[model samples]
Target: MEWLDWFNDSIAYVEEQLTNEIVLEEAARRAKCSTYHYQRMFSYIAGVTLGEYIRRRKMSLAGVDLQQGQKVIEVAAKYGYESPTAFNRVFKTVHGITPQEAKKDGAKLTSYPMLTFAITVKGVHAVEYQLIEKEAFYVTGLGLALGKDMEENQQKIPEFWNEVAAAGRVQELLPIMDGNSPGVLGINLMTKEVQEKWEYVIGVASKEVPIGFKQYKIPAAKWAVFSGEGPMPYSIQDLAKQVFTEWLPTSGFEYAELPDMEVYLDNNPTDAKFQIWLPVRLKRA
Candidate 1:
């Protein structure tokens, strides 16, 4: 699709300006879309912000420059870092070694290549979804800040769930679930400006908020609901990934700015089944 080409070309724009002062809006110019939507779409498709991608690409090349006898300060300045201290901190975080050590004999470094989006045959396993209209609803639960890094969220979310369950948070919220509402809801709520930054909340659907509970009102919208089976978290998580990586590009629907709802049906490990309600609307609707 032409959209895929424009998005790839935006990546090319970022790569070309890696060593210079990068204008983020220039990426939008290359893609022929607003800067906001381009970055928002990028976060959904790539699972990282455009800025984070640029940072990793710059650090990857900076590793090569350091190993080729460039001074740390020079490499830092070349990549738009203000100080060696800040550069060293980020370099070590990405590469697992100081920039000075990278110049030594046989130093190992991490390299994050530029990303590209494409549609490949994603295999025979079918991904199924349906469109439904839903009224506005509220969920009451505790939440944790979900940042842009997919890896970080993968680690944090399960720990958050564990903490919630161990503290009997689910039981406390269960007393109020409406008959129309599913049991405990695991919701991935994102901000309009940055889709990747989220607050993952586990709560119940209720109009009545308890004294110590937080309530989030999910606005009425058309939804694309998908079914998942097999296991907790992993199965649903994999389904969500497929929905984005495979279904979304070809689905002719863009996500509405709303929270995604995960409804767990039962506690059985072997026969687990759940539903994920993803807010969506027709591309031109």
Candidate 2:
């Protein structure tokens, strides 16, 4: 429950900082995890990116402020929008009406409250997983830098995969497979603060950093590897949410500040198999 306390503390911090410039490192410090995994796990468990959450929260408050007679430009500037136009665009998207409408009496508005982390089980049994220590190795592949905008990254990832497939990049990478890690890897180079952009590489474990491919190192650590069968991404994504929200809180381990992997075993249209590797360490008593 200490981790849960810490995770909730992180949320409180995010809520408090919404009116100021949010520093993700501070939130991760409270959560006791890497900025990357803290934000990554947040997206997985909450089914929305941390950025999107923040945006919703800002808009929700903006609606209230507008209803209380704050001018639209003032509300926009308060929420860090550079211009009233940008703020008004997002405001309508969130509240399903313009800021002017939000100020009208008896107008409907949506409120997104601050989130807290808690142990929740969907009546599902313990997720089957294996804890194994892996030696340091390397993966070589094409890399795309992922910025802090989680919603944009969500769309970008599928587009990246589609582009890779359309270009036969997977076939191009198969011959370079040299390490013992299975399948083509969707490796996250999440070794930086959230403010600092990270990379997501679609490649295989190989000793060689071949030309036209970027190479990244996977550090040695114990990983909680979850196996799943069926579909390309949804199956593994669901498993990951279960892992972070259901299993890890009781597993006596903490999410390590390291990169994780998504190993795709097969890419069949109806039956894809995959593994989600999460780096972990024993929780400090």
Candidate 3:
């Protein structure tokens, strides 16, 4: 099956068994992909990590049960927790209150409803994009492996950039920060499964990078580019979520196994612009 079809099928499976035990590996198996690839593709296409979606769904159901006056322990058991204490801990982490407290005090709780995919058309807006072919470029900067959770990644990425700046590595790497290079590039390395952990580099593009710095060769490929201009990371992240969640599935393309890149356009964080590159191969119509 096609990747998009596989993804839609996986979503249907998740919905069908929302109240049953679901494992990441099992979902990947159903999708006929590796767990890492499945997780990464799901996050890329869903705009949220699979784990986060599951947690939110569970919490939302818990809230519903709490509102219905069901006993906290019974609700917790229905969601697969062995003890109310464990459920309460996770519940409070997501909803900020124990089930009993939520039931007794009528506390306000956040609900993450299951997402429905839809396409909408109103006014037309022009999107600027180009498919360009270029030789491989080397990037040098601070690199780290991120965990499998999107929330954890969102929190750590900014800190990683800050640390690279505070340590003056950006200055040290100035030679590579030429105008053509634009801003620092954030590259996601493609390994096995999408969920499988991979290294991220916060660095600048260079034709000839220094020996000590880790270097990655981005091979010549076609890129679907999107531009974002506004606040620093927020704009960049928002564009990414839109592209993956709203654009990819509908576009006449599917993800190819290649490095995804982000190019910062301006120096100032509050008023910076960036470009997001997604590797693609044309889908057979």
- Give lDDT tens digits, candidate 1, residues 1-285: 777898899999889999897776688778765454466567767887777788789999999999889999999999999889999998898899999999999899999988988867774778878899989888888888876444566579889988998998788887888888776788777645324556888889998788878988778889998988886657876787788667876789876656777888776666688888878877753
Which one wins on lDDT?
2
Can you write out model 3's per-residue Cα lDDT over 89-180, one digit (the tens) per residue? 98998899778878876588989877654444522444566777666777777678876554576578778888887988777777767567
lDDT assessment of candidate 1: 0.80
Global lDDT for candidate 2? Answer: 0.83
Clashes of each: 0, 0, 7
- Cα-based TM-score, every candidate: 0.77, 0.91, 0.77
The order of the candidates by lDDT, greatest first, is: 2, 1, 3
Candidate 3 yields a Cα-based lDDT of 0.73
Model 3: CA > 4 A from native: 1-6, 16-21, 25-49, 63-83, 93-97, 102-113, 177-182, 193-197, 207-212
Every model's Cα RMSD, please? 4.1, 2.4, 4.0
Per-residue lDDT tens digits for candidate 2, residues 102-169, read 99999999999888777664646668999999999888899888875556777888899999889998
lDDT values of the candidates? 0.80, 0.83, 0.73
